[model samples]
Each structure stands twice: as structure tokens, then as C-alpha cells.
Target: MSTTTLTPKITMAQAINTALRDAMTADDRVVVFGEDVGPLGGVFRVTDGLTASFGEDRCFDTPLAESGIVGMAIGMAMNGMRPVIEMQFDAFAFPAFEQIVSHVAKMANRTRGKVRLPMVIRVPYAGGVGGVEHHCDSSEAYYAHTPGLLVVTPATNADAYGLLRAAIDSPDPVIFLEPKKQYFSKEEVDVTAPVPPIGRAVVRREGRDATLITYGPSVPVALAAAEQAAAEGRDVGVVDVRSIVPFDDETVCAAVRATGRAVVVAEAPGFASVASEIAARVTERCFHHLEAPVRRVTGFDIPFPAPKLERHQLPGVDRILDAVDDLQWEES
Candidate 1:
């Protein structure tokens, strides 16, 4: 919650690593458990050094069973422990969905204020890594649609660090999704930086021509396209919707109204995707302000493509610029 700028030298994955380390150090009750998280440091190495620093009890690896991972986490939370469970990939999270829905999500209310579940479930989702169907899946909607689940995603290292910390400390269960493809993407992350609170959107860029709304992996592409749009004499505003469950409609509505056009982007499939909800809600509230229809620039409805053609499959700078080109706007 403090804001002092440190040199930006960490990757998004590294920021997440530091965040988890800080959280564990701050709270003795905080326990990080996942498959291969101990000696293995997780499949993505986000938990690389925890076991050495905090010992095996605080940060340890778990069995391969998803249900067991989730069930054990819930038990630990009920007994006054803060558990952060990491699902290796989006696809592997499905096996634990039942446990999440039946127990972890409802433990607090179901017990009538007698028990609280303070746990964060982190899963790496969305297409673009040329991963298999499950590995690259964007299952935010699935969790968001479930009652009592707080779903939040970060498109940058800063948001990833702060938001994950918030999720870990919250009383309710949180579904924390990371864009695996963005793991290596570098950005200026000051370890001593102040992060915006939960359920907020960050306006990455300002413009008057059109609004590009996205989160997670597509945020960088949208920003790149906004820059390219400037060369074509177009003004584009980019809003990174960091929190998904309790969405930040104010920022998105304001940006779209000012621009009179909007393009919602994501790597998830177009049909019933989270991007669709953003487009639909914006179009509804900003109908009078919109000049052209609010269109979506998202991944194809098919499964994730091979690495060779992933750039074509997922939304990119060119694709975002093309959508911007289609929007109606006044030029000098």
C-alpha cells in the first residue's frame, strides 16, 4: 500500500515471486501449497525460492490430485490458516472446480459467520502460449459466474503483485488468474510501489478517438496498437480492467463515451467471453455516446493454436489497429 519507486528490473513472474515472499513473511499463518511449488518452484518458477526462505511447512509442494489440493486448503483456512493454492494451468483447475464451488467458496456464509475461508487460488489462463486446450484456457467466466468467488486478473507486474497480495489477505475465496504468455514480459515494477485497490481499472493511455478495453495478456497488445494508431492520426485510450468479478465499469464507460467507439479485446474465445460482457455493458450504458457499435477483438472460437500461428490467433497490435480502423471518428 506504500508508494516508493524502485528500479524496474523484474519480469511479471518475478514480481509475483516477490509479492508471495512478502506476503508469507508478513503473515505467519500464510501457507503456499501447490504441485511442484517446493523444490520445483512451481511449473512456471513463480515460487522458486520459498522453501529455502520460509521452510517446507510455509511453502511446500502438494500431491498431483487437484481435489486433494483444494480440500486440504479449505481445511487449513477453516482452522485459521491463510492458504494460497496454485493450479499448474487453467485446464488442471477443472478437477478442483467442484471442491471450490461446494466448499471453499461457501464456507463462510454457509457456516453463518462462524467460519471464514481466506484462500487465493492462482491459475495461469488464456491462449497465446501455443499451449494445449487446457493450458491456455480462459476460465475466468466459469469462476466469476459462480457465486461467492472473487475473480481478479492482472495484465502487468505491478497489478499482479498488489492484487495477488490483496486476494491473499481477503476473507473470501479469490480466483487469481495469470497470463502465462505475459510471464516474461518486462515492465517497470518498483517493489516499493503503491498499487490501486481491488476492483479498479487502470487507464494506460489517453485518447479521444476510440477506447480499447482489455485485461491480462491482451493489455500489452492493446497498448502497442494504441501507439501504432497514433501514427495513423487516431486517438486511442487503453483501459486495463484488472479486476474481473466486480468490474470497473466507470473507467470503461467514461473512456468509451469520450471516444464514441470501443473495442474489447482478450485471448479468450469470442462467444460468451468476458470481453463480450464488457462490450455489452459498455454499449448498454454508453449507447447515446457511442457512434459505432462496440466491437470485440478476441481469439477465435477454436482451441489455442500452435506456437507458429499463435500470433495470428490471439489479438495483436495489427488486429487491434484494424478494429480501431473500422471505428468511425473525425480526423483533421
Candidate 2:
């Protein structure tokens, strides 16, 4: 069955709310709970109306303890219930790191595949809204480094709805990172269509000059930069890597090979990050077809800065275009 129905144009937050509603209706065992998720409707109101519609039993609020919330979700999943828990903010989820890595991530393996840790950890990540400290951290690389977690970030309203439903239905734990910057962005979507499953990359724009690979908040930056490059007589492509962990290597490699040049973009720092992994993989897969070395446009290797300095810290469209310009397209 499809995860969506005919619905009016909505924002990413509303689309996600719709997915939560749909998931709970499809599966009675699906439950949603977290700090402020019940009556307050989550920090971004993504869980708004869930409690009123599904009742307290299905949608409720937990204490301010992140570890406890995740630990409880693990127990619930082990006992056969599907729990969807939310971390109020990106850096706020740090308190639950221990439970996530030690228990939630290892439950299925410890149970020898006999039990499935069917849970979804929703985190509102990335910057652009000028949030305070600890509110806009791009910690996706940390979770992606964890062995048992499936990390995914959606760039469009459709994936925001579809992928959340897919994550809730998965048999294992999933780290669903929503780009907070895109929460209010609106788009027309056909709710009746089934979106691609997790681990697939979608090419938002097609071009042969070069490929601009990005995800989450960086997707829009990459697309805009591609457009700017087009006006400059460079036909650049944009690839949104919806899933980070089980990355769509086939699609990424194909696009890079076709273009002969690539630039990866992400909001995370430039250390051992998702962008680093992608650049490395593209270099390995498309070495023969490359016109220049793969470039990465990412955040600085320092802590997330304050609101005023965020523009300088985060990678913007001009920065992405700078990386594209750095690509030595003249090579044979």
C-alpha cells in the first residue's frame, strides 16, 4: 500500500505529520512518544495532533531524559511493539548516545536475529535557522559511523513523508535525521505515490558537465549552485543522496562517471564525514572517467558557531559553486 493519499500542498513538517498519522493507522503496534511530543506537538510541531487523533496510548510524551526515552523504546521494540521516538534537537540527542550504541543498536545482533529492534529515532538536524548552541548540530556522521544504525535524511517533502513511514515499518532501528532548515519549505506532492525505499539516491537535475552530490539541507544549496553553474555555461547535475549509511553507490557512481567530475556537499565538518566517504567512493568508482579529483564542500572542522557566524561556517550555494569552479574540467 502507498504511504500517501491525495493531499493539498504542505510543508515538510506537515508532510511528516501525515506520515506519522498514516503509520499509526496502518499498524496498531506503532507508538510515538518523546519530550513535548504529546500535547506540545514536538519542538517543530511535527507530531502535532497525533495525541488528539491517536489518543494517549498510541501517542504520548516522555520525560526530558533522552537516554531513558531511547532505552524504553528499545524495551518496547524487544517486546514486539514498534516505537518511534524523537530527540528534540540535534545536539540534545547526545544524552541518549550510550543507550543508542550499547543497547538499541545491538539488540538484534545480541538476539541473534531472532528479535528485531524495530524503532525509529527522529532527530531534527543541521543549521540555517540561526538556532542557539546545541540546537543545530550536524551529527549525522557519528550515527553513520555506528554499525547497526541505518542513517537517512530526506531533502524533499515527498521523501520526508514517505521515508518516515518506511523507517517506522523497517524491522531494524533507523536514525531519521530531518533537515530542520527545510521544515517550513513547501512543495506540491502526490500523496498517493510510494516513494523509493531507504538507500536510494535521486538525481534532481541532469547534466553532463559535472555532478553535485549532496543530501539534507545541502541539497538545495547544491541544486541552486547547479543552476548558477548552468547560467555560466556549465551543465551541472545534482544528486540527492537520501540515505547516508546504505548509500546508493550505483547511482552516485553512474552520475559521476557520466559527468567526469564531482563535488560533494554536506553541512557536517570536513573530517571523517559523509562527504569524505562519498568523495572517496566516487574517486574509487570513477577514477578512469574523472576529469579532476572529486571535491568536497562542507562545514569547517570546528564547533558549530553562533547565529551571526553561521553563514560563514555553513556551506552555502556560493561555496558549492566555488568547489565546482575548482574542479579542473579541462583535464582529459
Please tell me which predicted candidate would have the highest lDDT against the true structure. 2
Off by over 4 Å in 2: 1-6
- Residues 186-279 of candidate 2 have per-residue lDDT tens digits of 9866666775698899999998999999999998888888889989999999999999978899999999999899999999998999999999
| Model 1, span 249-328: residue lDDT tens | 99889888898889999888889888889989998899999898898998888867756677778888988887887776
Candidate with best TM-score: 2
| TM per prediction | 0.94, 0.97
* Model 1 / residue 209 / CA error / Å: 0.7
Local distance difference test, each candidate: 0.86, 0.91
TM-score of 1: 0.94
Q: List pairs with backbone clashes in candidate 1.
A: none
Worst 10 residues of 1 by lDDT: 1-10
